[model samples]
Target: MTSVRQGGTGPRLIVHLPCAWDTSATYGPGDTVFGLREGEKCILEVAGVNNGRVFIDDVEVSQGEHGRYEWTAAFFAGRVQIVVTSSDASEAEYFASVGPSSEKVADEQFNAMVGEIQKFRASLLLGSSSAALAFDDSPGRNKLDSLVGLARLRLYAPGFLREVWEICRAPHRSLLQAERRVSLARVKRLHPLALREPLIAAAVAGQTSESPSLELLHVATSTAVQTFDTPSNRALKALVTRLAAQVSTLLDTVVQGGLGGELQEEESRRPRREHFLRHLLKETKVLLTREPFCSVSRLETSAASLTQISAQPAYSRAYRHGTRALLRGVEGARTLDHLHVSPTWGVYETWCFVHILSKLAERLDHFGWKAIRHGVVSAAESYELELSSGIRIEAHFQANFTAGAPPAKRVGWSLSRFRIPDIVIVVQSAARLDFLVLDAKYRSKRDNVLEAMESAHIYHDSLRVRQQKPNFSVLLLPAEADVPHLDADSFLFEHEVGTISQFSPGEPGVERCVDLIADWAMRDAP
Candidate 1:
């Protein structure tokens, strides 16, 4: 079991988790988990606001003193998955391993999520119309969400690999033509040398004959050459051959490595990639045959000519876009290690949630509400989405508590001057707007949850007076089952800030969140 030096004054709660749980094997007795004790003061080391969440017996425990709650189950049987994570389907990484210091992560779920996300991403890269809805189509907007990992940026990989396969699938071919050029030189054989009319007459008639011309034979000659044997074509051939070999090697690595066991299942499913590699290898072997006229000098000359030919506008333009994309795709093939080591995807979680929100918005088609504008507001740390009917949703990140004036609540200098709310979605109607201030607390300990509620309250009040619209708020905590709701309401009591405390922005949870927001937005709709 992994162990860190245990010397801290922060309150620590001893949670008795089951050994069968993923991370549970890292700590405690034979069947039970251990090290952390009940009613001991300790603190959970977290990197950022969205680092992790702690749950006891599937129910989330908020930040607080150890004495506040009794851990009677320390000696009993139970389960706990530490470091619960909610991530995008494409890039979900939950936990490491189970131990005294280790926590549980959702591996299977994450893999399934990734598979689904890749399918969608692939469709988008292929220019599918249905996939267009996943992105914001507003003018000057990025084709996809910016808050994504490196994997989604693989538009070039498929195309580049396919090009490689096509190149190797046959003997490389180039346009072959007999080119004729005029020359000025006297040669004994005039048949091969295209003779001018006067030179021909001079050659046909002896020098003593009348009308015999003595002009040096100016002639045009024609030569037949295979374009494929040209240095430019050879260079292209070399590049494709190298790429095919490298791709084959990489595919083997991916298939064999299990990507540290993260992608074991993926190895068997991608038969198409493997199949293409086989054909490419076979074709590359066939095309490597030497041409009859390819002497050392000719080959050297051809190689020298390649640089100039490839640099020309026609060839360069073709390779620039495709080659760069191919390189990026190749790099992406090695990203398995990065996904496993990093604990958090940071604000990408919020971005994933935004995607879910968009899906929910689209579901409102029966109501004649379509997403018209959804894009990142460059000036601020906020993203906005507008429906066809005039309803607008804007999510602000780490927003300050103010509309345009001084502090509304002078409870303390810290709470008064600025209140940090993780997410503040402003849903505006045609005539007016409303606010849903949600604190996306990764961990829902008593102290953290209370602080979030306080901030939500202050933000709701601060904006309510200035905007003069209904403002509701909620404490968004990552948990197993829905936790007991606390008595949190806005200062005006116009709306209640409840808990999406247990639900995450994964699948069903995101849908549930959408239902809640849609119901709230349509509550007073015309």
Candidate 2:
């Protein structure tokens, strides 16, 4: 058995799973260890496999003694946990390790990033849930008391809870309409011929010879009716009922864990948040057992028919007014593949930082959508912002300002090229545009710090506009770095270099930095 110590030197991440049937020494049940990096290698080792199996991210790797499993960390980043389960043993030990690699973001920053992204994602899931509801007032009711975390369970577990609810409540009206089919037979009574075909067929069949007045002349007909028990509706009923049972079971797990109440109680002072959930569950059971059935797909087959039945209005309610369409814009979201997993923490942190900065800063007016870059030659995305004081800020991300045309056509294009800043704040005030470039370095390693600062300098020197110096060229890193002089100066070409932590929004250092940046933007006002 390899005895790996905590916090080993070099770029390494190690987790020691203590020998216990229930290992909660390092992490609680379902809790994950942080500081995972991409493009590295990971190894998992089992000390003893008495009757145990080891799993990583829910995928079984190996079992038995001397079992060593290895995988590349390129595709997997974010939280990693080790689980060892033994049927015939009381305790089992496991150890997982990752090879040295570039330092990823701090744990606090990563958690904050995940939380921020989860906020919007949660709202989308809740909206989808509301759409699945059958009542007219459900949107308003859910707005007052929907638990998004519970709603997100639909993402992790693939099922049709919403579709079941939709069908159970309304039960496609078209399918409910009863149609009668008439057949001819030799029988006991004669009936008025709304349709003469059946009577004529019975007469021609020579039933009259059996008993002249009462046999062939008297046509008997059997009526076959269409109902929910028919094959089409029955198939739909089977599917929805099965899914409802599965979803209800998963919901029970969430309820027992008490996840929904905690999240909902935090949002509202109302004590009945859990009450609403109980009611929903009860309704789900009743709907699943109802005799009448309907197909959700058939309801959505036409735009006009659905509207006539008031079903289309339900989806419209899912979209929040005056906001970007979250759930509606994405295709195949019914299966919820989009919301199933968390994005990489590095990417998420950058997005959260920009979001917080854009929202909190009083000077800035507007910010655009995040543009994801796919290749080196791809054009960088710039968020457009307009200040109340007639200043326009174009915030570029990973842009290479030095790779463009020559100095003859541009101003101060001196450096050779190839510099990509994490965020480049280009302030356009009056006739010139000055830069306040930033690089969001999540890792606290000294070498990475130097590289970030060096890149910031390249951007400042290469992107000069006719003697107009940069307001500030800063490195935005995690708070753990404690880089010196983060809030010292912001004057153009005067102490313009510094560091600002991404986690330092309300902190004195970040407040001071934003104040200085805002003050500098207004300093040259005409």
Candidate 3:
């Protein structure tokens, strides 16, 4: 309790104000008050004020152990008044303001930051919960800039809730370990934004990391909650949910100026703001880099920002639209050379785009003719089908040989597998040939049918399952090769991959490859 003496000779007035959420009750480890999901998001505001000039006054409060919110002002005189209210009206107020004169109040500067934080928080609840959604009205990079502002000021706010700053960061190994010995609920009280920052930053520091930090906010009638679930060996789950219930219009009026913009945004790019970013960077920030299955990829990067817009719906729709648009635009690229390539890069936009496409094909609940299985497809074939259109079959496949050390081990698997012939094509019903296995060779010349047949026979007889041998085994080669067919139909001169001698072994000609596979499918059935 912080109170200022209405009448007194004390150098400082002792004014005791109430902490937020006094009635709704403080949070417990399992309490559902915050409703925070593992990946759920909401922009948050955890603001504090010090009017009493209380440097020694350690105002301590918390939602759990070690997660304490403590901030000290200039110094606690014999008396003072200090208070912390949310940007919203009437949720939960955390405060104790002390001052020599009861008239002394919260600084308008502080109030303005709270106001901006509130506006952003309010906006999160408006549309939907998914941040990656690409809606027309979705909040963009601007939300990150605004969130940065709150991140900056909140770090130094006069209450003793300082570790909220660190906890918000990626989390220091030593400090967190030390915190466990303290108590519980001491950690959840800090703003989720404050807690989320460091985690996002680590991704930026990694060998490869760069992405936008988006806001995910959920709003309810009296309160809106932003939360994350942390796994613990001893604890079932740790859910950190921050709520703002006891907000006043007057206070919201005070702290609304702290929200911000993106690194390159017109406002954020200004030279004057360089110091602000520098300060944020210097403050030991961290942000959550891992955002799988969620949008608003709030990963930390080279820059620090405080923007907040609940753009879940906006981002998703935008990404879907944008990718589809990008794909439609790809027809101009006639060859593989046109695809962007950078050396040593572990990931790329192309990869992300392809993955997202798979996500789309899956999500719309639409299954195409692809449901029909075709003969085996090569690795290149699988890659092509996903990217290319028109003539196609199914079983998007890949052919790969696991390598081994010694030469003995090397020729090992490759020879045995290759023994059966690389492919089998089918057209079905028309041919009663039973089954046809097509062996593709780089050699422009034909193989010695008797010798090759003997090797293949050995491989076939080894098949664990016994019934009947393949009705026909094919050997496709260049038109210039010698012909030897144990069974007259067993061997044929067919141009597919390339001339036998000069053929590039791995590159399967797309059309030729498909025809060969379809041939096998038709033959193998009977």
Best by lDDT: 2
* TM-score of each predicted structure versus truth: 0.41, 0.49, 0.21
Which candidate has the top score in TM-score? 2
Against the reference, the lDDT scores of all candidates come to 0.40, 0.43, 0.25
Residue 226 Cα positional deviation in candidate 3, in Å, after optimal superposition: 35
| lDDT for predicted candidate 1 compared with the true structure | 0.40
Put down candidate 3 lDDT per residue, 13-131, tens digits, no spaces.
12211233222223211111222211122221232322222111112223223222333222111111122323342222222222111111123422232233223222221110111
- The per-prediction tally of clashing pairs is 18, 1, 143
Give model 2's TM-score versus the native structure: 0.49
Question: Which tens-of-lDDT digit does each residue in 62-105 have in candidate 1?
Answer: 55553222222221111222322223211111221221111111
Candidate 2 lDDT by residue in tens digits, 342-432: 2243344355345445553544434443443321222245455556667765655555545544334344232456555666555676765
**What TM-score would candidate 1 get against the native?**
0.41
